[model samples]
Target chain A: MTALLTVDRLSIATQARQLVRNLSFSIAPGERLGLIGESGSGKSLTSLALIGLLPETMAATGSIRLDGTEVIGAGERQLVALRGPAAATIFQEPLTALDPLMRVGRQVGEVVRRRLRHEGLPSSAPAVQTRVLELLSRVALPDPERLARVYPHEMSGGQRQRVAIAMALAWRPKLLVADEPTTALDVTTQAEILALIGQLVREDNMALLFISHDIPVVAGTVDRVAVLRQGELVEAGPVSDVLQAPADPYTRSLVAAARTFDTALGRLF
Target chain B: MNGTAGSMPQTEGKMTRRTIPLSLIVGGVIVGLHLLAGLLTLFWTPYDPTAMVGGRLAGPSLAHWAGTDRLGRDLFTQILIGARIAIEVGSGAVAIGAAIGVTLGILAAFATRTLDDVFAAAFDILIAFPTLLVAMLIVAASQTASLFTAVLAIGIAGSAIIARLTRILAKRVLSMDYIVAARVAGSSWPSIVVVHVLPNIWPTLIVNLALQFGLAAMAESSLSYLGLGAPPPNASWGRLLQEAQGTVYTAPFGAIAPGIALVTLVIGVNLLADGLRAFADPTRRGRR
Candidate 1:
């Protein structure tokens, strides 16, 4: 498979602190790649740097190519253009990710209208609303029509996550970057959300870059896994190879920790 | 929680929860009184605000609701007419201060550099001087200040406080993920600020406006009392207070009438502002 999104020796820095150093990864067209790392291990920062979503305080060096278009040092307008139709992000906290004041339907509709405007297509409010409802339905949100009129704050965490997923898929981007999309969800809800993302990526034939610290969470969702520790990639291989037969000492430690944590949690329940 | 949930709509049942309605009523009453006074003055006052009905320092009677000042002008009528000037100055000055302050604050927050530093320094410098002193100096520098000039001077003096508040609120809103989401969605800076940023900070601004109305009213009255607010021939509570000050010992009602009016108006505004602050609080709403 050919790479749809590629990062070569990408380094991101905030003020005097280096976050992601010499990070290189790629997502093949229609492939799901999981980048697993503990907290502050540069996983999320690498993803943000790839999409040019890093704050003004941060600086990045090295190449970030999304479908052969270099994103490094791209102007804000250029980044904006790339954000919707080319690449989109699903943040960790869905509750915080979506705008509270705006109705979920309008927010989803905005992406479609914005993309249409960017492509110089005529967009009507009714037409956008219809498309937004359709997208919500596509995400398996029950009662799409009713849901469209509701604000983000009015919805449950699971429902909000579904809305966020719908928004990410609104532009039908070739690549979706999900950063701990299910971290805040319960175990059952987490399973459902991960399943939804996996199903959607397969159906759309879209490349997905899933970032999580949970080993089993990514194991069941992604095709390949790249493990990071202390801002460096420690292991990269097929999910089966990395999870079932872990190579790096850090990766083994993670697997052991995840198993123990799950066991402890199960005992608690 | 169940009892609280059940009382969400009923008036008596939700008395505690219905603070917003109560606030609206109070705000409406205060605003309505000011408006009615203004309209009545435009058409006619009970007696001419400037007219001397009898001897100076006359006590309250059926002919004069409040009494007569040293100049023998009807105190009640003067206050009724002056309500328009006081409300105008209070609301107008707050509007001006908020507009300038919120704009500069949001700009400084978004800019976040030497530009922000410059605005912060300027804001701090302006705020360092006592607001009354600043208003006095501005009024002193320009001889014969009109209603508009008084409002402007008060607004300029009040802007420093508003700007600092707006900057803090705007910075908090600017850091929210939805703001980042808007940016990623390709929203222009102005659009983001207006559509996303402004709406989020609107409650804060409303609370500030209410609080400032009370402050501006007191300031206007003080300035007028000091002979710096409105010129002669224009009715103001402060100016009325100044006129009655001389005869306070002889006929205390002369001074007491305008003084009471000023205190009542300020109290009403402050209470309404407090109510608004509570009404606009989301956590309080959630608890209910």
Candidate 2:
């Protein structure tokens, strides 16, 4: 089995200081990897570098090869080719991730039609609409017909997240990068969204790079876990090993934090 | 104002809210009347707008309507033609401004760091140079201050402001996550601009353009008043106002009629822009 994504000694830096330093990770085809980190851990920066969409002020060094193409220093045309069909990202804030002015259906349809165009298939209105509805339904959204007409502001947080998920899945990318996809939702909605992402990844047989600060959530979603602190990778291992007995002291602290949170919740119950 | 602007639409719903805005209604009526008067000039006026058809400084009557100007030309006829000229100049200048401004702005928004700075500096300098001063320079250069010259000067000068506005608006939209999302979804720059950026920014752009229309019209009248506008027989409202300045005490109607016409048009356009801004803003709409 070949690796779907390979990041080798990747370092991202602004003009003033380094943000992500000497980080390396790889995800094999159909594999799920969770990157667990604290704030300013360079987790988000690494994810952006994977898609070649880092902000202009920051410069990225080292190699990021996704499905055989090098993402670092790639031109916009090449990056555009890789973005949807190869890998797509779902950002933290679903409300801002989707376009507010556009109807949700049209938004999804835009991706579907682009995918069709990329595949050299006819992208007529009816054809696009059918596929759009199929994608909406696949994400377990009820009443795809009516939902497509309403704007993003009309939908709840969870529904909007589902729509974002649908958009990411529209092109059937080989890999999905979800950067704190459920962080903006409430407790109940978070569980639902997390489950949906896991189920969709499994159903599509797609690789996933799930970045989150939540330890238990990462453990539940991914097979392998990589822990990041500041700008460096502190630990990498199976979820069971990391959670049950962390090798690094930093990893141990993270597991202990998760345990404390679990115990607090247990006491509440 | 926010509360009133937001609530009125929700309570009225689709039926009335669509046109229920007080500014839009009042502005629409004033502009509509002006438009009717302008259109009337296409076929008829009381007399030839430039002809000496009545006694000079005569008062309003069935024959002369608003009476006559110093030259004995019908004031009512000149005022009607004035409306037509105002509309022509307003639309023409705005069209030119929007075209030049929007294109440059979008280009500047997409420009690299060095190019963007250059564009920004240029826009600032151009904006600081008064539109009237620029118009004077253009007239000086052309040596013929026709309606075309006025429109060109005003549009060119105003383009800097429009471009600056467009650059700011487009850059803000480009920075949004949805724009990144669109790109990730395989949308090309052109596609993203058409599908996302333009649709997001057009509401604000339109509101500003509406305001620009008023400014351009006023600028045209000022040019005519300064003797740089369309020559005699065109009967621009500014020329009428200028011509009536001396006889203002004698006729009173001469100055009052064109002054009222100019003010009404400007007020109408300004109110329309205000109404549009209130209606189109999402944050304000979200309050409802």
Q: For this target, which candidate reaches the highest TM-score against the unseen true structure?
A: 2
Off by over 4 Å in 1: A260-269, B1-20, B271-288
Taken over the whole model, the C-alpha lDDT of each candidate is: 0.81, 0.88
Worst 10 residues of 1 chain A by lDDT: A149-158
lDDT of 1 by residue, B64-104 (tens): 88888887888888888788888888889998898899888
Once fitted onto the true fold, the runs of candidate 2 whose alpha carbons sit more than 4 angstroms away are B1-20, B277-288
The count of residue-pair clashes in candidate 1 stands at 0
Pairs with steric clashes in candidate 2: none
For model 2, the TM-score of its B chain against the native B chain is: 0.90
lDDT of 2 by residue, B1-288 (tens): 121123232232223233346776788788889999999999988787767887878999999888888778888888999999999999899999999999999999999899999999999999999998887788778999899999998888789999999999999999888998888777899998899988888888988888788888889989999999887778888888888998788889999998899899988887877776666654345343
Highest DockQ model number? 2
Once model 1 is optimally superposed onto the true structure by TM-score, how far is the C-alpha of residue B120 displaced, in angstroms?
2.8
DockQ for candidate 1, please give it. 0.35
TM-scores of the models, in the given order? 0.91, 0.95
Please name the candidate that would achieve the greatest lDDT relative to the true structure: 2
